[model samples]
Target chain A: MRAEHIKIGTSPPISFEVGSGECLAIDGPSGSGKTRLLRALADLDPFSGRVFFDGAEQSEMPGPAWRGAVRFVAAEPVWWTDTAREALPPDEACRSRAVRVAAAIGLPAAALDQPLQQLSTGERHRLSLARALADNPKVLLLDEPTSGLDPAAVALVEELIRYRLLSGNTVVLASHDAAFSKRLANARIALGKKPLTAHAP
Target chain B: MSYVALTYWDLVLASLLLLINGAISFGFRLNLERSLAISAVRMVLQLALIAVLLKFIFASDAFWPTLLFAMLMLAATGYEVASHQSRRISGWRGYALAGGPPFAAGLVTALFAVTAIIGAEPWYAPRFFLPILGMIVGNALAGAGLVLDTIADGANRERQVIETRLALGQSRFVAMSDIMRRSVRAGMLPIMSMMATAGIVAIPGMMTGQILAGAEPGDAAKYQIMILFLIAGATGLAVLSAACGSVLLMTDERHRLRLERLQSNGSP
Candidate 1:
């Protein structure tokens, strides 16, 4: 996946490229357009410049098709359905994969059957990550993917992401967790009040 | 028996009843007297003007004049529908989105009713066509405005949920289907309730007017029922179309949620 001179909202033009099995950490303080940058990459927000996935331009494919291959999981999770199970894509394979990811991320199987409104903030966040991972897109844009998780759950999330990386899926994430970034990200970009900079870790 | 004509003095006497509302406002210090008086005056002037215009159209009894009057009413209905929206698309697009569906639906429904059902001698006769078009279009305007309002407000409130679905690769239509369904339901609810309770809860205005004008009760009841059905049909079509149009306007071909396109009334 690659973006060249992408400008989102009032932010400066950003450009980056990540190969298969690589993780790009977008390091930035709060309110530094980290989420906006992630949104641009996902094509959820309008941005200038070109994005290419596997030699296919973002605009060349339909929005949903492009998004399906490059999925985005927001920091603050949102559920449109009543129960966790219903919130999955309503397909057999996705549901089964969601269950597997849920168990791996320390979420009980019973939690999937319970009403999402009854879940804790951290639990909902984990479910959202599980939902994204179940799709198993070529590229994942995660914004604050582990903000409210416990240390144990956070470790489990890291493990799951590491597994994804091993399987050759690219990831771009924004995180305040320095240790988490250090552990996962092979390349990094820093966005702040100062001009943006990118470097290999 | 022929209908009795009301004198000017009779209308003046009837309007005197508004003083009771003015009295209540004064007694409670509600400060509503000014608005109430202005509304009363405006209603009287508007209705009197319409009465004169209708008399002229009926006297002329020509197709072009009647068609022109119907078009004028439709334009006015469109304006009213757009004005009622809280958060509307800006410029001519806002008015077109609010008014276009209802105009098309209402015209089609009224034409079908007049030509096929009622069998009016001249399909565009002022007597039958004008009144049927007026009622259908009026009800459709209400329904379209309501559905547009609900969809706009719902989109704003559920931005995150909608964006999540979009990010999950759901098409824009699929992402917004739930809200569109709810908004269509909201728009249709009023007509459904009215149809359900028409004869039992209250005598409908058209039926009451027909009875006062000395039409047989049975015939008046039949016309009222037919009119109610036409209203329901037109309202349903208008609302469904309005929801689809609103969803299209709210999102783009790129399938991005463009909430910035909507602006609250009275804001820059």
Candidate 2:
């Protein structure tokens, strides 16, 4: 995934490219367009720059198709339906995979059958990531993936990100955890910092 | 059987009913007497003017006047639909989105009724075309208004939820498909309720009017059935058109939900 000269709201022009199997951490202060940037890259937010996946412009492709390949898991995850399963994809295979992913994310498989209102905030957050991964996206846009998780759960989420990277999927993670970014990301870009530079590739 | 027409004296007697209601309202201090008087005045004046206009229209053999009148009614209805929305789509976009559906549906259904059903000598005959078109346009206009209002409000309220679906690689159509169904269903509810309750709880106005105008009970029933069918058809078409239009207006070619495009003028 490559985003070039992307400007959203009051943020400065930002650009970066992470190759297949790579993880790029977007670090920023609060209100520094971290969420907005990820959304722009995913084509979920309006922005003024170009985004490309494997040399193909995001705008040139159908939005849904582009979005399918570049999945975005929002920080405050939204569930429109009652059941957790309904919030995921409708296919049976995806449902089973979601159950597996939910378990892997430290959520019980029974979580999928539970009503949305019954799920904890941590569960909702993890479930959103699980739902995004169910599609096997080429590029995953995660906003604050482990914000509300316990230390153990955060470690598990980081492990999952590493696992995703090992399997040749690209990830753009927006996080305030600089230590975690350094531990996992191949490169890091900080918004609201003067002379923003892409770290060692 | 011949029907008796109400005379000026009968109208005077009808005024007594309103006076009685006003007296009761005033005695009870219900604060409704002023509104009741105003409503009565408007209804009498508007109906009187419409009757005069209809007389002129019915006497005319030209089709242009009839078409113009239909357009006028459609425009008024479009304004009503747009005005009723909580998040208004301003300017011509609002007018087009609100008015276009009901007009097209009403006109098409009216045409179908005149040509296929009624088989009038001249398809645009004032007597046949005016009343049938009025009924169709009126009902379709109300349905379209409800549909537009429901959809606009729904889209605004469900912004995050829809964007989440859109980000999940669901097409705008697929992402908001459920809401669209819900909005259209809500829009059609009144018509559905009226249809369900027709003849059991209420005799529809058109049927009652037909029966009072010396038409046979069976003939009135038949006409009512046809009108009901036309109304249902028109409402469906209008709701479908408005739903599509509202969805299109709410999104861009890139299939993003542009909620910013939905501006408000402080009127819901």
Candidate 3:
């Protein structure tokens, strides 16, 4: 996946590329357009630039198709449905994969059947990540994936993401966790500074 | 029994009942006296003007005049629908979006009823065509307005929920399915309740009017049933179309939520 001269909300034009099995970390302060950049990459926001996935342009494919391949997981995700299981994709394969991801993320399989209102904030956040991972997209745009997790759960999430990377998926994440970013990202970019810089870790 | 004419003195006597409301407003210091008086006067004038206009249309009984009047009524309905929106689409497009579906649905349904069902001598006969169009348009105006309001407000309130679905690769229609369903239900609620309680809870206005005009009770009831069915059909179509139209306006071809298209009416 690659973006060329992408501009979001008065931020400097951002350009970056990540290959298969690679992770790119976007580190910035609060209100620094990290989430906005991810949204643009997911094609969920209107941004000026060209994004290419596997040699096809973002605009070339339909929005849903592109987003399905390159999914965006918000820091605080939203669930429209009532139960945790209902929030995952309704297909059989996705549901099974979601169960596995849930278990791996330290969420019990029974938690999937519980109503969303009963779940804690951290539980909901983990469930949201599990839901995105179940889709197994080519690229994952994760915004602050480890913000609400305890050290144990955060380690588990790191392991899950590493497994995803081993299986040849690319990831671009924005986070304030310096240790997490250093461990995961091969290349990094910092926003909010003039003339943004991208460099290898 | 023949239809009894209402004299001006009878209207004066009946209007005296409004004083009860005025007295209540006064006693409570509700500050509603001015609005109540203006509303009462406005109602009287509007109804009186409509009666005179209907008399003129009935005397002429021509197709063009009837069509012209129907179009005018539809335009007014469109304005009313647009005005009901708390988060209105900015420009003339707002009016078009609010009014277009109901106008098409109401006009088509009324014309079908007049030409095919009633089989009036001249299909566009002002008396039959105008009344049928008025009822359908009136009901459709309410329905379409409700639908627009619900959809616009829901879109604003559920921005995160909807955008999350979009981010999950759901199509715009799929992302909007819940709100669309709710809006359509809201639009149809009034008509549904009216249908449920039509004969037992209260005699419907059309039936009552027909009975007072010396028609047989059975015939009046039959006509009422037909009108009710027409209203249900028209309102359903209007609401469904309004939902679809609103969804189109709220999103783009890229399936991004374009909430910026909606301008807030500045109310909390």
Q: Give the range where candidate 1 chain B is weakest over 10 consecutive residues by summed lDDT.
A: B259-268
Better of 1 and 2 by TM-score: 1
TM-score, cand. 1? 0.95
The segments of candidate 3 whose C-alpha lies over 4 angstroms from its true place after superposition are: A193-201
Q: Please, what is the whole-model Cα lDDT of each candidate in the order they appear?
A: 0.90, 0.86, 0.90
Stretches of candidate 1 exceeding 4 Å from the true structure: A9-11, A194-201
Highest DockQ against the true fold, candidate: 1
What's the true lDDT of residue B51 in model 1?
Answer: 88
DockQ for candidate 1, C-alpha atoms: 0.82
lDDT of 3 by residue, A100-177 (tens): 999998999998889988998889999998888777789999999998889999999999999999999999989889
Candidate 3 lDDT over residue span B1-268, tens digit each? 9999889999999999999999999999998999999999999999999999899989998888898888888788878888767987878889898888888888889889988899998988999988988898899879989999999999999999999999988999999999999999999999999899999999999999999999999999999999999999999999999999999899999999999999876663
Residues B1-268, candidate 1: write the lDDT tens digits: 8799899999999989999999999999999999999999999899989889999998888999998998788678778888878899878888888878888888899999989998987888788888888898889888999999999999999999999999999999999999999999999999999999998999999999999999999999999999999999999999999999999999999899999999888642
Error of 3 at B86 (Å): 2.1
Give the clashing residue pairs of candidate 2, or none. Answer: none
* Residue B262 shift from truth in candidate 2, angstroms: 2.3
DockQ ranking, best first: 1, 3, 2
lDDT of 2 at B157: 86
Best by TM-score: 1
